[model samples]
Target chain A: MTALAEPIGRGGAERASLARRASGWLVLALVLVSLASLFVGATGLSPFAFLKAMLAGDAVDLRTKVVILDIRLPRLALGLLVGASLAVSGVVMQGLFRNPLADPGLVGVSAGAGLGAIVAIVLGGLLPPALAAAMGYALVPIAAFAGSWLSVIVLYALATRGGQTSVATMLLAGIALAALVGAVSGTLIYMADDAQLRTLTFWSMGSLGGATWGKVAAAAPLMLAGLIAAPFLARGLNALALGEPAARHMGVDVQVLKRVAVVTVAAAVGSAVAVSGGIGFLGIVVPHLLRLSIGPDHRYLLINSALLGAIILTLADMVARVVVAPAELPIGIVMAVIGGPFFLWILMRRRGLMMGL
Target chain B: MLTAETLTVRLGAHEILQAVDFTAHAGEVTAIVGPNGSGKTTLLRALTGDVAFTGAARIGALDVARAKPWELASRRGVLAQFTGVAFPFTVAEIVRLGQASGTAGAATDLTEQALARVGLAGFAPRRYHDLSGGEQQRVQLARVLAQVWEPLDESGPRWLVLDEPVASLDIAHQIEVMELARAFARAGGGVVAVMHDLNLTAMFADAVALMARGRVVTQGPVTAVFRDSTLSDAYGCKLRVNVAPPSSTFILPHAALT
Candidate 1:
């Protein structure tokens, strides 16, 4: 009773409020970017014209309607889902690893997922005919999830000791895993037929170009499961920042939390990579920016990262479509160009405070 | 009551703690004191379930090994020797993590209240990483304090299990921390602290458990355990305990050894 005084002017409350406020701004950005994406494709449908035609009850042309509804809508949906998944996965990974640099891409989860997708694509025929038929379109995403899940388990085992994660060990192991995965993927690529080769080439340069309702349906639930599951792990992840033993002391079920977090990351990253290929940097970039703006509380960080991630990736997708006109650049290229330099800047700024990496 | 009977901790092939029997009653401050590498920390960790140990440790009737983490956490708050925040969390935010709802639901303003108790009033906005070592340690203490703000809850008396709580504090702050622990004990809670400073231990502890080489060398009331022979033999040095000052005991390493 002696220490219990009047609690006043709490900063945590203010930070939480700021994070909540930012979500509104990010939602607005997402809407604006989504609208722009709908109208700014290579086919060039003017938004004003489309709205006017629809308002006037004029029968929109089949081609125009198809472009707007079928192509742009699914692409936008897939973009939002993949973007949110990547960003949320990044938050979870950083929280689990207790380091901001611990991104899915940086830690080779993306590469592992990529390997899974390549394996599924190149070896689909080798599967028992009945099993392959039953798996259908879900095969690639499932394979990718398994691959990412496996990689996370292996990485966690290697880099973590007595509940402390070694950033240096994680990064080096990531590079090593990526190299091994690349070699495996290369062997698979070499064996691919010409048709599979085209699919492989296009998929490697991450793009939302092949977005179909079927593809969206296939990947959405997996990513949605991950996105939904992440917020539940937010408090646990927050406690984990204080180290495993302390987190456990704080009533966090550290083992269960870690298991959920690993699965959530795999589910999100694996499916996102399956559909969008290796879309680099959205995971690290979005979460880092949100942390800088809103502070590192996962309660806010997870949701805000989802919103901002969707906004950024959608915006990136628009730029990818607009910059080259009919022949679009891969969104992956755009992200790497932006995120690579940004990552280097972060590394330089934080060189002094790697927290004993 | 918190009790650990025949507690043994083995890390790989090394036995960090061997057959350590310990007990601390509610409304008392029990200090575990010993020289370096005396297994003081390991014993505390075993009691707190931070380490895997072969022992029967109990908080009241709840067994340490079988009890869920939340079950134990609700009864006691632990302050580890070192806590590193991975991200740039504010002081208030870190402390808020100790609120009951830190695991879920909405949390009250206990964050600021705890900070004030640790002599860190109005430090809620400062980044945790920017604080000095002593300040950071106090911040962690504030967090642990917030976790079990009420010494005696409806269930029973809560506990403060601290490992070198004042290791990084200044002399004045050291007294402040000891006084805080004493206040908690006075308010019907038990406090178990792993201490290195024998003088502070003598001044504040109600009971003492002097340990050496993973075993309890002596355990009893402060007067009985703070004898010159017992202190000197356990610490492996000539330690002189002055009983001249009756209000608070003092232990000094003998200046001239025989």
Candidate 2:
């Protein structure tokens, strides 16, 4: 008997226990960061000032109140929603493919959503900005959902038959689709006039520049829905990590499972892109960090991923504001800079993980 | 009671299983043995409904191919080859999944008991992938053990199907798993396994189906499949079979007889 298997399993158990313990810490961290969001940047307000302005709405500067109430609050709310959403989707996506490298954008679902949002921006330009925002945001997710569904459909159509989905083939299809759609997005940029190009460019790189209460309102439910639904998937995913035939012999309905996993991932990731332009790294980072911390038990792994994603993004976006002072860095840029390196580390170290390791 | 009748599995244009007929009543172990690509796994998969095939497999009164998956799952528990190694699942959790084949409360308690039967009682928290190949096989057997170990329901008897369950196991675990399967049959459940080891098959299997190139060359008691003529015919080589003096049959390859 290899001592490694038991110890490793025990190690996973140990980490799961640790994750369960740190879970409270992460929740506290999010709460503290939520409070910190109110206090961060240019306000020069003491925590008391921040709290006073929030409770009484009688700050000396109305702009400070506006900054806290209108701007920061919505941003915090959207950041939390988008972060948790991406992270949950990432957990589901990586678990489904058993590939740690999989991310909404890396696999092109977000790019597809990006393309949808672009189309809405360009096509909806005929309407007013508010209407265009409504149409573009609405259509972004619908388009992203449609696009993601299409990519999944194509992947399934090409690689799956006889009730089997080939992970390798689906991944290759995602890579190929990402390149093709990315090229289309680039072409959309080239075709746009300078004015249109600016929004398109920002959306392309990803941003949380438009976190209205309305957008947050829209994203929160779907994000919450995904978060709530994720833990139930843990057992099925655990069975699946065993592989198609083994799972089947063990009496899992493999085809039904794949369908549920893909659709749920689409719903979670799609709604996220609707609110936040194309936040990168959150999805990939959340699940990988959780997996590293908690092992592959989807039961614990999924919930931990959600918590970590929420915490990391909330903190990241807060830092993005303070890093540059009054001129805020688009959070998409911040996440990419931080998340890109980690992505490389995962990719580089992944040969040891050929079987979705 | 479990039986497969006229089961034909077609792979593209080639027939992988050509009208294979087999049966195992509760209280017996049957080994489906053959060389690589000899339809051993194909037959087993077909019986488990892991593949679509043109034939009928019945567990008691329910036609296995047509039974609702949940219905069939309760009646027949299967453990295929130990190929997939997913990290992070403790030995207990994997076995717990097998308990899903039983009543809710019984599932948990039986899973614990099944692990102990395979000499892995204390290994509940061990990572499944971290185990050596043989130990992993034992754990998987523990899972199937949990599955079929369900006390009989009023509806149907439980069936155990394993495809190359011991292929990756070492000598000790091999005997452990085989004995476990044998005990399942003795306990009034049916166990049908596809095995590569003729010696082990001879030792424990109540009957054997010797297959070659998708056809059953001979199907009978263990004594019939172990004969010199059938052995030579199945392997396409000159072979010798001799009974050892230890009060049981022992087969040696011609190359090892020195």
Candidate 3:
């Protein structure tokens, strides 16, 4: 037994170090990407000059201050929050369902939030004038958050019975829900005039262009709350990878884990969608890439997903800002373009595993 | 001792398990043997509190159904027949999940020892998905072992509730696992295994419970329960029990005449 144990001790140590190294590198990458994002926008304001001016307490130009502080700073912060929320939510959903393909967008949570935002946009005029005026710009996000919670509640009700949740049922129900919500959103779009149609188009296509201090302030608390709650779920999610029965046997309250995970995903994604629109693929792609590089230990995976998700989204937002120069491209288009092919590659590589689906 | 009395399970309109009484003593291996659909797995589930059942089940002094999951987890470990993991997890990571029951101190050392005991030394870094079916089963067994690494705690004895643990292993590995069970029992732990291979069962199990159609046909010490008529009637076939030297027995099923 001693002879057999010798090699394992070395291997276990090596794997532990490897995970540590991977996490270290991901953190470094996130910091570098964030710094680069501050300088890579269309306004041509050098981050170095801005930093130097601010540090020296010298007179700074108004355009540079507005570009850096007003626009880019809030945008960067929103990108980080939204990205981290979506990615963490994706990790939770995948672990909860015991399937790699589970994502907030694919599972209809994002669609539900999008519908909520659209309803607020299209129907806000119907509210009594005083009430609509009082809600101000906060109405869309509030409505979107409410919509997200409602849809998740409905989805949970449909997918779970007798303390067991069926992943297949959840996925199918998500697809159906997406279609139903899309139809309603389309009807709203048809009723809208040209200006409302423009707002709807930009919102649906997904962009960080509209990021503002108010939006960031509104969404950050919910996203932060969800992100903080995620690490506590690491152990339960890890046990769940072995399947529900084995997870329960490991002393994890599987039912409670499911409830917490669903609520977390909904709150995070709902707040994100309310602010950033339906940013596709970051949730799915970030966690998938991290799992490929590092093993599926949710303890490390959740943190790394948050870091990498933030990095990737910030970089993508930079691309969306610069690729079209004076005219910005939607961040959703950028993510979908990169993520769609990567998703296909993962599917092809894991074709045998997908057969079980 | 782990005890279950008047356990009955109903799913929809069908009864999966009828009223059944089971008792597995500490420091012994109890094997439940039966044909397919004999409710062997369901019985294990009920005992582990994985499924709702109308019965009284207790491990030591705590009622299984009412005990807190984490509290129960510290005392009992379970191995399911089929375990499907979605992401790529290393064997070590999978084994370490057993520490979720709050066995944080010494968990790493115990995980390594557990893997070594299952003949999977140096497999800590190996991906669980890349392993063969038998290897994965052993990995799961290693996880179970890590969960109950110490056979006895402040509590009297721990329990290992397994569902068809060796159904996927090769012949040699089957004996290896059975030997682990025997060793565990020797160390003063309770092991209740749902088994299909009667030869292995006869060799390793101190007590045998034979079941047919959701009911225990007969249960007792190995020698008394391995009688020819009881097994033959329960299995719906002709079986002859051959007693071998060193107090072992083997059951052979006779072929039907054309």
On TM-score, the candidate that comes out on top is 3
The parts of candidate 1 lying over 4 Å away from their true place are A1-10, A106-108, A120-146, A149-176, A189-199, A340-357, B101-107, B256-258
Prediction-by-prediction clash tally: 0, 2, 0
**Estimated TM-score per prediction?**
0.90, 0.87, 0.92
Sort candidate 2 into its docking category.
Answer: acceptable
lDDT values, one for every candidate: 0.84, 0.73, 0.83
Candidate 3 deviation (Cα RMSD): 4.4
Model 1 over residues A121-152: C-alpha lDDT tens digits? 88987999999999986787678767876787
How is the predicted docking of candidate 3 categorized under the CAPRI scheme? medium
lDDT of 2 by residue, A1-357 (tens): 011122234533465576577577677778988888767864555778656755896644777767777888898888877788888888777767766666765445675777777766666566677866666556665665566556656666776866677767777877788788778877877777887878666765666655677777766776677778778788778777767676666667777777777767766787777677777777766676556445667877787677778777887787787888877787888887877886677556553542335
What TM-score applies to chain A of candidate 1? 0.82
Better model by TM-score: candidate 1 vs candidate 3: 3
Whichever of 1 and 2 has more DockQ, that candidate is 1
Clashing pairs in 1: none
lDDT per residue (tens digit) for residues B1-258 in model 3: 999899999999888889999889989999999888998989898999988999899999989999988878888899888888767777888887875463534534677788889989878877677789999999999988888887876768888888888899988899899999989999989999999999899999999899899988888999999988888888888998988887679878776322
- The numbered model that scores best in DockQ is 1
Q: Please give the distance, in angstroms, between residue B67's alpha carbon in candidate 3 and its true position after superposition.
A: 1.4
Q: lDDT: which is higher, 1 or 3?
A: 1
Fnat of all models, as shown? 0.64, 0.41, 0.63
